[model samples]
Target: MAKVIEVDPEGLRSWIGSAKRTLTIESEAMARLIQALDGPLGRAFGEAIRLIKQGSGRVIMTGMGKSGHIARKIAATLASTGTPSFFVHPAEASHGDLGMIGRDDIIIMISNSGETAELRAVLDYAKRFQVKMIGLTSRADSTLSHHADVALCLPDCREACPIGMAPTTSTMLQLAIGDALALALLEDRGFNAAQFKTFHPGGLLGAALTHVKDFMHKASQLPLVAPTTPMAEALVTMTQKSFGCLGVVDGESGELIGIFTDGDLRRHMSRDLIDLTVSDVMTRTPRTIVSDTLASEALEILNSTKITSLFVVDDKNRPVGLVHVHDLLRHGVQ
Candidate 1:
């Protein structure tokens, strides 16, 4: 337990000033990272990315202490994005987890000093197993750096700790370097949002949110009326479906002729309601989206036109579905 110390504005201000000075060290370290970007280390990173892409098996990242934590995060990010990856602690690997390493796996080991005894043994064993090796570190001259098939060196940066001992800016650069590799691989693989959704399909955030067909009411579910139908009939169909609208189509080929809505009904109140036909009452070929389109697109259509619903159609101009504002909201589509 610690006692609470009395402090005032001046003490707080001095603390703020000290914190502000740390930002300068971080900035200067980031600048030094640019220099390391052009050396053999850069070539090594390119090779590591290539090896992971071309390799038939998964990627295994391992490290000790702060590096181990970073390795775990890097593994997770890579696994989520496009690559299959997992973390192995150097100490744990030394104990028994070494059995998890496979011949076809790409091994990425991270360390600031690159001389942790446990990591060195892991690297040595990995070489015998013929697993491809990638090393990340600040000191290129370290034994771990020398033994790696690919060595990624970080720029020299001052630790923000008062004694200059804690891993601060070093961790940032390590994480950033891993990000660069993962993102570079992602771009090269042409990984898009649609592909990303295949790996993550829960919480209503899947690719289904992006495609309109997943949320739109299809075929018979779509509210529609014949062109010769009365305006009153269109209102009844639209209201029953609760889509705020109805598509008017021809009897033969089901091609869209027009659309009628609550707005159309409001404007035609003075006319003889009984004599009003969809042909005389409907708006011409109202705005619509294709079945394969995104649900967010339906929201866009509604917003841009100041309407609450859109008719979804297929290639032959046949009404396929109806998408309403409520539907997008229900599906969590923004």
Candidate 2:
């Protein structure tokens, strides 16, 4: 077994100092990067966005080594944000993956040094096919910048690593540039949360973005009662629906006017309670939600009001559906 070595207090302090230094270096590099957006780099970035927006084909991202990892992440972000994108490894591109690149597609190639040998095949293929290329590199005089239709040259900055050779600040800048491009495209196209939800429809993020109507109990499943319904009958309806609450609606207009819960039942618990109508025992103007409400927001309402269920109402104030806290929890809203 490996020995459990305890770090000395002085050693721990040095470690913390190193971590802080790395953050400071990377932060400063990011600051320098934003300043370049005012100049040629900004123009190049805009051109890239326009190119992708106008193209019917997908965005192909490629890089070598650590740049490859950043390329994959950027591709995923672009794809999820409404832009069709995918990552192709440069080494693999040389070995037949280059077939994935289409003539109409725009290629965003990442390389801190701008001279990765593995990218040569991809560069040659892009040139041969007249495919537009966007180069992300720190070297303006490099071959990549010379061949690219739009060269987004990163500002010169020091690496966060002590050796100064590892990809630290450069990778951070690359990731940031990728995110900026994706968001710019998203804004240009007016992509909304509904589209985002469509792409991310399986995880906690998907659940949070899910509409209340999608998970709500509609039609016959809602625990609803007329304002004139007696408390004895309303109790049976609530029990049958198993939502722990009842929406009191008007018989003439079919609009929700009140709600009855266990708390209301306890507050009105008397020998005369059975004889009272639901209108008298219910709480008027009860908090409700719309069908378009996000599940996260619905959960927030339920928690803040300390209620387990809410009626999903329409513009007419009619109870169209019902949502329970259990339903939100079941869908991973929390």
Candidate 3:
């Protein structure tokens, strides 16, 4: 049988208090790091960004132990933000992976102590190849910092762990610095959302960034009627298209002029609706979108206006396509 130990309320309270203290310590450490950014550390950050931006090769990040985990994340962030980077295990470099390092590439070595044994081979290879090296370390006098072309020395801060051994606050600072570097590079390169969408084109984010033209109903599928057409005929077009709405266009200019919807039908039900022309009942100046508009934007309009459909128009205001909220939802635009 499993042991059934009695719960201790006082012990639980003490655990909670310890957890809060850890969080408070780490928070204060990060705040000190922010304050340190305006000094020599700030100049070092700027120089690192300049070197990486001017280089014609990718950034090669290498580390060991806990720093290795942070290195992987930093590499991923740099790659996804248009920096072209990848993480390499220092242990792997000793065996044969050192061949992956190019003379043109910039090496970023991460180590809290700046003396991780596994990193020695990679650092030697970088030096021999004459590759530029950037060191992210807390110890400025350590071997990694001594060999690096640029050293981003972290501010002096104790670990959040009560024993002061495990990497707690140090890892947080490393991650933050990595994020800062990636964002700075992204801004310097003027990386736009369109380029970002290109990199992230396989998930909910990709679906959300889809353009309106990709899923909109084209001219053949659009329910359209002339402004002078009888409301009875417009209703037939609406039903045939099965979009619950009809775009009213000018017969001479082929330009969109108004829209007739199910709501309009309900509003005019008490009048001589059948005898009215589309010009008499249709709503003028209906909302519209261009082919280049994002599907997410169209979704926003539909939700904000509580309307079901929008006409996609060309430069001359001619109806070229239609975008229904259902179409957007079907394509996962939301």
Candidate 4:
């Protein structure tokens, strides 16, 4: 048997109080950050964006300790959002990683005090190579701010830590600034979901961003028949295709006009059903989606309409493919 731990009610209350205080402090710090963005920080931010967008080479991120962790996350966000970027440790740069910095590259160096000793080599290298440097520091007059092409000064704020030493609110501000920068660049480049899917292609995010065309059954795989097609033949094709639905097309134009589903089958159930044509029971103007539609949107349509599948249509309203809810599920799309 596992040993049960005793709970201290009073201690628990104290812990909760501490947590709330921390949240309040951090929230206040973030509010100050909003004001900070409207001043010189804002101008430097715009300059950094222009440098990054204009640069032909990748963005190089470097920092030390807690700052390094935040830098890595920022680099990842930028890389995933279409801006090429990578993190290089400041210490490692002094050894040999400085070679990673080139004249065309943009360097974003993060340090709360703007005086992290490990960053000296990276700073000197950027200066020597004429690499554009964007400094993220709380001190406006620090060495980093002086040497950087653009210095984004962080708003002075209290740390959430009880000792007021550990990075808490400051790191949060850094993270928010990094996200803002990445999104600004994303919008500047007109990055879209389809382009985002190219970078994230192996998880729930990837599945959500995936286009309908990727999961759609196309060409011969579509369970299609003409409005004039015999009900018996259409039923056979629907069964053989195993899609539980059949598309009806205009024989002359080859454009989708209606769809035959299980609901229609039950509505027209009778002894003379097989003798009728597909047009006799098919539902007209069926819900459809374009190939560029996201799979996540397709799932929403399936859930909202309480249906299992949808047809992918071209600009001409011709049925190009079919996407089933099962296809979305199998690919990890919610």
User: What is the TM-score of each predicted model, taking all chains together?
Assistant: 0.85, 0.94, 0.91, 0.94
Q: In model 2, where do residues sit more than 4 Å from their true spots? A: 1-5
- Over the stretch 1-334, how does candidate 4's per-residue lDDT look in tens digits? 9999987999999999999999999899889988888998899888999989899999999999999999999999999999999999998998889988888899999999999999999998888879999999999999999999999999999999999989999999999999999999999989999899899888899999999988799999999999999999999999999999999999888899999998889989999999999998999999999999999999999999999989999999999999999999999999
lDDT of 3 by residue, 1-334 (tens): 9999987999999999999999999899899889888987888888899889878999999889899999999999999989999999999998999988888999999999999999999988888888999999999899988999889999979999999999999999999999999999999889976788789887677877888888788968989888888877888888999989999888899899999899998988955888989999889998999988887888999999999998999999999988889888887777
Query: After superposition on all CA atoms, how large is the RMSD of candidate 1?
Result: 3.8
Clashes in predicted model 3: 0
User: Candidate 1 vs candidate 4: which has greater TM-score?
Assistant: 4
TM-score of candidate 1 against the unseen true structure: 0.85
- In model 1, the clashing pairs are none
Cα error, residue 283 of model 2, in Å, equals: 1.9
lDDT of each: 0.83, 0.93, 0.90, 0.94
Ranking 3 against 4 by lDDT, winner: 4
lDDT tens digits, residues 138-218, model 2? 999999999999999999999998999899999999999999999999998899888999999998999999999998999
Clashes by residue pair, model 2: none
lDDT at residue 317 of model 3 (Cα atoms):
97
Q: How many clashes does each candidate structure show, in the order listed?
A: 0, 0, 0, 0
